[model samples]
Target: MSVSSAIPTAILTGFLGAGKTSLLNSLLKDPMLANACVVINEFGEVGIDHLLVEKSDENIIELANGCLCCTIRGDLINTLTDLLARRDAGSIKAFDRVVIETTGLADPAPVLHALVRDEFLLNRLRLEGVITVVDAVNGWATLDAHPEAIKQVAVADRIVLTKLDLLHGVEGEDKMFAIIGRLRKLNPTARLLATHRGEATAERLFNMGLFDAAKKTPQVQAWLNDEALSKVHRHHHDVSRHDAHIRSFSLRDERAISPEGLEVFFAMLAAHHGENLLRMKGVIKLADEPDKPLAVHAVQHVFHPPLRLASWPDGKAETRLVFIVRDIPKQVIEELFSAFTDQLQGDAMTDKTLSLSRT
Candidate 1:
């Protein structure tokens, strides 16, 4: 693949004062991200981070229009379109990947929706993953008080616990771990990493194949072995009447899904539950193409066009989808899938019989 095709876009999101800019600076210093194009959104009038980022020239675009969550969708689309046009025209060195650093107080759902819903953009761009930075010191309090913080964590494919160095050998260490444990419950599918001075490896932060990004391995039957999910599930079960605001669930079935049917189902789901659906990632077995599996990943409502892997990593044929949702019943999603499979089964049978008779 070419450089443009090789690169993957990532969204950096977190609540106010969660160290998003610091993380961005760290990423920019890394040689791995040298070919990155950054989009920065400032919540206030003065944009200081643009000055902080050591860009070569004109690669970093700042959207001073408004907060990304509310009023900058047009600017974002236009900026991205222009960026792509310049890249294709060979005006600038072809960028490997694009990174959008959202405002600290921004809600990422709307931003994601705009990226995935646009017809022209969706074909060219792919949502690699969402990286949410959580302040190790104030994370618990922030999640408890701010709905935006909850949404940030909920939609993340990878969660980075920042400011760990500040808590060294102090009482805050235990508190930070406990907070991370709680966040694990909120988003078990997302890999959790501890970052010092906002520094981390690209391999640890990205390429999460909806399974184990850190391990670079597929989790099929091992999904049940994820300690984060089990620990959180137990905690929720222990406190049944507590704040049931956010719930995480994993659904796996042996049936293979058709690519067309999967597309329609995802489009419908995104339209209906754009706000409620936080993060979704899954590895699917397609009925028509059993030799290759489809990998589906989405942050909020934006989905990367399904990627077809050469072969299943571990020879497992099951389709597994993990969802981190807010106030959305697990049964609703389950029923939707059940209905889709039933309808598709009928069509599959007809196609199979027709093919057999022709042969």
Candidate 2:
């Protein structure tokens, strides 16, 4: 398959009982994901989501209702390979996209690795994005206790906060804001949207990568959320205790930097602190092309190649890097990146530091 023709795949993940299956059901009801295939991976030998889904077939359930729902029979790679064969043979519907719903306990890295490292799937499929469903009612407690939940929030490309109705006028009202604040701190760059009973439109959740879906222009500002960089709001003491290990912050610099310098900084970051570097993404100001900011992103040690946009998104011409790290301090990243670029002055970084100070 040609590069452009590669199927766009989105991984939908969240902690256990985070309403992933409910969101999948809601999305399947809509025409937004028409001709899309789904791979449901549950924890045990017997999958639950496939049974929960109202489908006809067990292996390759082709529903005119909307998308194709396929339960994982073997490993994910084998399952994807099998789906491709079915599509090629006209046994099932031809799908332009694939959405993989992982079990709540699964870590996304290995799953992404399966896609990235697979030879057959690499040319035939492309990772469209990762969408994480956050259960607002129990999400705070989940994050506090589960490392899996924290990782889910960190690596998410887009976060959907579900169960908002449960928080209305309840004593857990403060907990709702607390969850939002925690999500922002864990992944400030990810676009956070609210949903009720998994009612969020499929279109809004998908198609959020380096570029905006409509114009394919760089979406630096939209995903990066510069406003998040301006302040790190504090959560209640109970909330704080849950996510003491995970830290989120932004490093900013108005000065334009050379690509070579940025590459060096990137190398240093991944080499020195790959594991602690949970997720990092942002657009940077380049001296030669000030208007065309460069987009960079990484999950752990896997770094996507830098993309230079045609123009700034929404005219927010500034260099900002949003980072979600574990056991790594904000000052450590600022000093390391600045040391390589020589673009951040001590006082300038200090000023930005003040903006990110815990409230």
The number of the candidate with the highest TM-score is 2
Residue-level lDDT tens digits of model 1 in 20-62? 7677666665666666666667434224355443333433342
Per residue, candidate 2 scores C-alpha lDDT tens digits across 1-359 of: 65457787889999888888677777776787877888887434224345344556657666656578778867899999999998999888889889998888988877776776677887788676789999999998898788888888888888999988888665678888878887887776677888864446887887666433224554446677756656656554444554677777888887777777677567667776777777787788987889988877677777765667777776767788878788787877776666545665667644543343321
Each model's lDDT comes to 0.66, 0.75
As a TM-score, model 2 comes out at 0.79
lDDT of 1 at 52: 41
How big is the positional error of residue 148 in model 1, measured in Å on the Cα after superposition? 0.9
